[model samples]
Target: MGVTGIGGFFFRARDPEALRAWYAEHLGVGSVPYGMWETQAGPCVFSPFPATSDYFAADRPWMLNLRVDDLDDLCARLEEAGIAATRDPEWDMPGVGRFARIHDPEGNPIELWQPEQPA
Candidate 1:
């Protein structure tokens, strides 16, 4: 019970430069070494995908979920920045949250979620 939360996430990017820039530009995540993001108060979903499950794209093993305050605004910003934000109503839960997916410049899927209530 000592672990409080996730400390960091690391993944491979085909073009690290462009991928990093994409996140930084649109999502405001600076390079990880000393990056700082203005995060909002919300529940961060922490779950592990089963080995045989095909929930996420077959190519990548993990998806990054970032908590946001305004899903609509974020989606619009991403779209305006030329980032395709895919909204799947099938993934919505009545009281859990809403989700939208987007791939980084390197094709790494990023899931953005806004919880039903602030955490």
Candidate 2:
């Protein structure tokens, strides 16, 4: 049988506890060891970019893209919390979705995507 959906995402953190708390507070990403988050069913993109691609920072090996319901409201909340979320008009696709970029405390790139609604 082929693989199913993504079960988990593991990564190293300078301070695991603090980072865990940050994620929980800001993005509602649950922690491990019994803190599994139930995400809504949606399209999940699984693709790799070229090594020389400038879509994200060169120093970071991978960028995390998260599906969101309301990009504008989320970006506003993030800004109110003192986290700067940047958006570029060029990044938007008419039929694909809208996008906003933000960096976590430890400097990890996070892309927030709000997909176009089906008519």
**Which candidate number has the best TM-score?**
2
CA shift of 27, model 1, Å: 0.7
**lDDT for each residue of candidate 1 in 5-80, tens digit (9 for 90 to 100):** 6566667767667777677878888665444555544466778988777877987888888877789999999999
- Candidate 1: misplaced stretches above 4 Å? 31-33, 38-41
Expressed as tens digits, the lDDT of each residue in 34-74 for candidate 2 is: 45799888899988999999999999989999999999999
Cα-lDDT of candidate 2? 0.91
lDDT of 2 at 2: 88
Stretches > 4 Å off in candidate 2: 32-35
Clashes of each: 0, 0
- Candidate 2, poorest ten consecutive residues by summed lDDT: 27-36
User: Which residue pairs does candidate 2 place in steric collision?
Assistant: none
TM-score versus the correct structure, for each prediction:
0.83, 0.94
